[model samples]
Target: MRIFRFSLLTLCLLLSSIISFTLYAANDWYRPPVAVSWYWQLNGTVNENHDVDLYNIDLFDSSAELIQRLQASDKKVICYFSAGSYEDWRPDADQFAEKDMGKTLSGWDNERWLDIRSTMVHQVLLRRLDLAVEKGCSGVALGEVDSYRTNTGFYFRQDDQLRFNHIMAEEAHQRGLAIGLVINADQVRELVDYFDFALNEQCFEYSQCSSYGAFIKNEKPVLNAEYRRIYVDDKEERNSMCQNALTLQFSSILLSKKLDGSLYKPCR
Candidate 1:
């Protein structure tokens, strides 16, 4: 009885330590709210005039001073990068091995799908995350994260994608950086607990906005961008879209497909 009691006590202490560490890890990083007003611009000069809570800009294009300027203005900046695909224009594009490169993404030239299971790929992305840390980004917006749902000329099981995403999230947290799942709505329920937030593109147009209810219910932010012309050209479409977004508690905005600063209509 004495031995059993000591073992039980040991187990209890171990469990307590684990729970404490998990909570610490979760709270140690940044957590954006469900109602956060954010902007996503990948091209041209980043417009800083919007009364938004966060700015999502290209990771490489943004200067450290720009990140500092945004943070100084009391806005959180989420550095953007393509984690699941290889973009040839990046400075570190050559770091990806030929074997890891797959078919080109539709309508996106010079960008090819990457093998999600590559250790080398993970290392390269680790450096990208490090860059985010070095540049003082509050969080990272990982694009093309739903490679499993695309025709990437690679055989990626759902488990493979999940493992890869988990690695990215774990590594991001290890560096005290928050990360969001960009447009990977299919895995929203499974990954909501792991990611800090969700960024969906055209979910309203495609009738996929409901998938992100999981994020809102969990009190995590769902930042959606609609590029459809109807939302921009018609007042009725804009109102309906904004209504759904408001009902869903999403930080929705109408943006250009180019993602330039020329377009900005946010529905808070």
Candidate 2:
């Protein structure tokens, strides 16, 4: 009888362990829904009246106090950090190894592609995630994740990209923060299952808005930004874009190239 009782106790302990592991796994798989009051600019003060559901701000530029203030106002704050590229202006830029750095991004003069497979780059990104957590961000926006499709100068393959993306999701989940992927519309189908939501640029202007429907199909929001010259210069085009954004069910906004807090014309 004693041996039987010991065995039963051991089995109970094992089952408890399994249940704990399952709960952790389930939490990692779950992602919170977002509403956009997103601002990419890191230099200026956040408008208190934006009344956005989620605000995406630079992880390095903004303080924890600002994130807390937003949260106090019933807003979720998502910290924006570049997981795939190296920006020279960032405070931790010097920590990136020279060998891990690749070709300069096409339009962004001060940034360069990073080798996602490099151990050094991974360490740096881990530190960034730690920072995001410390700042009390509800989620993280990983930028430039599709280096496999870009002129990365690293000869990276699609499999490499997939592995990198999965690792990113794992890291974010481990830290108890939701993870978001920002990608060009072309890679949406390939990465739809992994990302919590989609942050798209100019999908309406390029007529590739339909490609991001995969995220919507998964019951995730698609936050879009359109930078058409007419949308900025002409009021009529802005009104039309707002209407189109409503029909598409995208939380669309108009942002300038500098991404400063100048004008955030949301779709009303």
Clashing pairs in 1: none
Q: How do the predictions measure up, each by TM-score?
A: 0.90, 0.86
- Per-candidate Cα lDDT values, in order, are 0.92, 0.82
Q: How accurate locally is residue 211 in candidate 2, as Cα lDDT from 0 to 100?
A: 88
lDDT of 1 by residue, 20-74 (tens): 8787666788899988989888999888878899999999999999999999999
Worst 10 residues of 1 by lDDT: 1-10
Candidate 2 regions off by >4 Å?
Answer: 1-25, 28-40
Candidate 2: tens digits of C-alpha lDDT, residues 102-193:
99998888999999999889999999989998999888889888889888889998889888988987788777777887865767787777
Residue 23, model 1: Cα distance from true site in angstroms: 9.1
